[model samples]
Target: MLKRIATALWGKFESTAELKKFGFLAAIFGFIIGTYWTLRPMKDSIFNAIVGMDYLPWAKMLSLVVIFPLVIAYSKLIDKYPRHKVFYILISIYACASLLFCVAFLNATLGLVNTVQSPWRLIGWAWYVFVESFGSLIVALFWAFTTDTTKPDSAKRGFPIIVLFGQVGNILGPLLLNARRLGFANSAPVVAICAGLMVFSGLLFCKIT
Candidate 1:
C-alpha cells in the first residue's frame, strides 16, 4: 500500500538510491522554503501593527536602502567562503535575529517596552527591513544550493516534487500562525517558532553531505 503511494507520488526512479536522494533533498528544501513563507506574512503583520500604516512607505524605502549594502556583503561572502559555510552564517544570523525579535515583541506585549515610543518603534522598523532582506537572501541561497547539488537530469525529475513539498509548507505555515485556533494571539511564540524552524533548516543543510 505504501509502495503504491510512493510510486504514484514520486514516479519510478532509475534506481532506489536516486529515489532516496531526491526524496531527501525535496523534504529539506521544502521545509526551509515553507518556513520562510510562513514568516513572510508575520513580518508584514509586525510592521503594520507596530509601525502603523503611515510609516510603511518609509519602511519600504528604508529596506531598499539596507538591501544594497547587504547584497554587496553577501556577494563578498560568497566569493570568500564555501556555499555551505555561507549558508551557516546566514541561518545563524537569522536565528539570532528571530530570537532577539521574539524577546522584543514579548516585552512590548507585556508593557516592558513601549510600542508607541521611539526606540521600540525604531526596532520594529529595523526588523521589518531585516526580515525583508533575510527572506530574499536566504531563499536565493537555498535555490542556488539546490541547483549546485542537483544534476540537470535529476533536477528535471525531482525539482517539481521539491516545490510541491515546499507549497505544503507554505500552506501549513500560515495555518499555524492563525490567531484564534492555534492560540498564537501573541508575537513572541510565533517568532520563537520561526527561530526554531530556522535552526531546524540549518541542521538539515548541515546534513546535506
Candidate 2:
C-alpha cells in the first residue's frame, strides 16, 4: 500500500532529488502546526480568566483525565493507519479540534458556558478539558506520522530539518495563540478556518499518498 502511494505521488517527481524536496515540503507544511499549538497555554489563560477563574483548574484536570483515554485510542489508531493516511486524518482532526476548542473557549468568554454558582460549572470544566484533548491527540499522531514517513537515509539527512520544522511549529502555536490574544477575531472562527485547511490537506494526502 505504501509502495502504491509512493508510486502515485512520485509520478510527479522525476528523480530521487525531487522526492527529497517533496519530503521537505511535506515536513514544513506538516510542522507548521507546531507554531500555533505551542502558544495554546497562554490563550487558555486569557480564555479562562475571561470566562471565570473558578472554572480553570477543574477544566485542566478534566483535560488531563481525557488525555489518558485519548492516548489509548490514538495508540490503537496508529496501529491501523498508514503514515500518510494518519497524517491526512490528523490534520483534518487538528483543524476541527482547533475550531471546536475556539468555540468552547469563546462560549465560555461570552458566558455561554457560565454556570453562575451552578453545578453545571463542573460540566463546563469537563467540556473545556474535552476540547483540549483533541488538539493534544492530533499533535501526538502527527509526530508519529512524521517519524514513520521518513526513510532510513532521510532520517539521517532530513530528520534534523524536520525536527527544526517541528520546533518552528512549536513556536508558531504560541504565536498564533498570542495573535488571538491581541484582540483578533474570535478563536472559534479562526480555528474553524484552520479545520477547512486541514480538510483540504487531507484530500491531498489521500490523493497523492
Q: Cα lDDT of all candidates, in order?
A: 0.75, 0.56
Backbone clashes in model 1: 0
Candidate 2 — worst ten consecutive residues by lDDT sum?
A: 110-119
Error of 1 at 144 (Å): 0.6
RMSD of each: 2.6, 7.0
Per-residue lDDT of 72-105 in model 2, one digit per residue for the tens?
8777777887766666666666666656656765
Runs in model 1 lying further than 4 Å from the true structure: 1-11, 109-120
- Which parts of model 2 are misplaced by more than 4 Å? 1-32, 35-39, 101-127, 130-135, 176-186, 200-208
Model 2 TM-score is 0.63
What is the lDDT for 186 in model 1?
A: 61
